[model samples]
Target: MKPDEIVVGVDAAWRRSGALDWGLHEARLRRRPLRAVHVVDESLRSDDFAPIRLDGQVVRPSPIPRNDRRLVDELEEYLAGADPALDLAADLMIGAPGHRLAERSASAGLTVVGRRGIGGFARLLIGSTSESAAVHGDGPVVVVPNGWQPAKHASAPIVVGVDDHDQNDAALEFAFEMAAVHHVPLWLVHAWEVPAPYTWNAPVANGMREQWEQAARQWLDTVAEQWHQKHPDVDLRHELRQSHPVVALLDAADATGTQLIVVGGRRHRLPGLMIGSVARGVLHHATVPIAVVHEHRATEPNPGQ
Candidate 1:
C-alpha cells in the first residue's frame, strides 16, 4: 500500500468498470500506482445457518466462504484489459467494504468508488459504501458516476466549490492539481444567499443580497489569484451564484462540461453528522465524478488567505 497510490473500491456485485477506468486515468495523469480493493463483509459469511421457512417448507442455505479469490481475479482481469502497462495491484480482504476502504484511504493519494452498487436501490444515486468512504475517509474520495468514460470528456474543465472560509483549501488544491494534470481550465464557484429572516423584509433582503454577492466576488478573486500564482500554467475562472451550493456546483459543471467536481468534506465526531449537507447533496445529485477532500489534510497554508 503505497502512500501515493490511488485506491479504488472494486465491488464484486456491481459493474465497476467506470470506477476502474477513472482510477486508471487518474493514475496515469498523476503517474501514481493504482490499487483495486475488494472487500467481502465478514458478517455476511456464515459457517452455520439456521433453517428458514420458505413457502411453508424448512430450507437451510449453505454457508458462504470467507475467502473469495474470484472477485480479486475479476478485478485483475478488468485492470489488465483497461491498461496492461499500468502499475496496478489488487487486494482481497474480509471486512465491511466501506470501513476497509476508508481505513485504506488514510494514506492513499485518492480513493475512487462507483456512485451506486448492486445493493443500492434503483432510485438511489449513491450507494452506502461510496458515501461512507467519501465522508469517513481521511483523504480525497472521488465517486465516479455510472457509465462515465474519461475519454469522452478529455478536455472538460474541473469544477470546485469555494466558500468564504479556508475549509475548502484542500479541495481547491486537489482541483488545481487535477486541472494542471489534465491541462484543462479550473472553475472556482462560490454561492451565497440572504438569510431567511432578512428575506421577510424586501428592502433588507435586497441590500443583504447585494452585500453578500460583493463579498463573495471579492473572496473568489483573492482565492483565484492565490491559486493562479501556485499553478501558473493552469487556467483559472471563477463565478459567484446566489443559489444553493449543490445547485451552483451542478450548474457550473453543466455549463462548463466539467469532468470532475471538487468539494470539501468535513469529518464530525458524532454519528450521522459525518458529512456536510452540501457534500452529501452533491454526491447524491451530481452526474459527473465528485471529489470530497478533508480540510485537515491541507497541511500547507493557502496563499493570500
Candidate 2:
C-alpha cells in the first residue's frame, strides 16, 4: 500500500482503455505514480479462464505456473503497447479480486476500475466490485463505464451530489478540484425527496413543497458560497431538485454531458440517509465516470432494509 500511488485494477478485457486512460489522467493531475493491479483467484486455473464478449483479446489458457512475474510481464507488455507515457507498474495479488482491490484502495489516493458486468473473477472488477470498493475503500473509487472516453482538457462539467451531510460536502471539494485541474465546469446538485410514509397515500400540499424547496435552496447556496471562495476559477453551477438523488444526478449528467459524477459514501453506516444510495444507482447506469469518495461515519445503512 504505497501512499503516493494511484491504483488501477484491471482485467484482460479490451474495454480497459477507458479506465486506464482515466487513471492515467488523474495520476498525471495528482502527480502520482500509477499501480496497475491484477488479482488472481487461485481456484480459477488457466483451464477455467475463457474469452468473453467485451474483451477484444483472446485470453491464453492460464499456465500451470502461478508466478507473479508471468502476469507482471503480461501487464507491462500490454501497457507498453497501450500508452507508455503513463508512469505505471503492475502488481499481481493472490486473493478474491474484489476483496483485494478494496483493501488496496484504502491506501491509494484513488482506485480506478471499469464498470464490469457479472462473470468470473478474470474480469476482476464487476459492478459489484466497484460498488464494494466505493463503499468500503478508504479513498475515492472511480468507476469508468463502458464507452466512456477520457478527455484531457474536458469542457464538459463535473457533477457532485451534495447533501446536508458532512460526507456530501466532501464530494463538493473533490468536484471542485477535478474541475479546476481539468479546466471544466462544475455542477452541484442537492436532491430531496418526500419520505415514503409521507408521500405514500397523502397528497402533498403546495405550501409544504415550497417550504422544502426554499430551505433546500438556501442550504445549498450557503454551502456553495464557501466552495466558491476557495475555487473561484472553476465554473460553478448549482441546482436544487425535488427528486430522487439518483434521478436528479443522472438526468443532470446526461443533460450536461458531464465528464464525471462525484458522490460521497461513508465507510460506516449512518442514520437518516444511506452512504451508497446515489453512488450505486449512478454507477449501474451512468455513461460517464463516477468517483465515490469514501468518508467515515459513525452509523450504518437503513436498518429497515
Off by more than 4 A, model 1: 13-17, 48-67, 296-305
- Deviation in angstroms for 263 in model 2? 0.6
lDDT of 1: 0.83
Give me the runs in candidate 2 sitting further than 4 Å from their true place.
14-17, 45-71, 81-86, 117-126, 195-197, 200-204, 270-274, 296-305
Best by lDDT: 1
lDDT of 2 by residue, 1-305 (tens): 66768898776552444676788777776777888887776566545556544467654455434455576788787666655665778888766677888889877777888777335464443466666666566667788875566763267889998877555655776788889888888999889877565675445644377777788899999888888998888888998888888999999888888889998866345432335556767766677788888753323346778
Tens-digit lDDT string for candidate 1 (1-305): 78899999977653644787888888888778899988777667666578899999997665445335777877777777766677887887667889999888888888999988768688888888898888888778999987799989989999999887547777888998999899999999999878778877988777677677788889888988988998889888989888988899999999999999999887454666766888889988999999998754445355568
Worst window of 10 by summed lDDT in candidate 2: 267-276
How well does candidate 2 match the true structure in TM-score terms?
A: 0.80
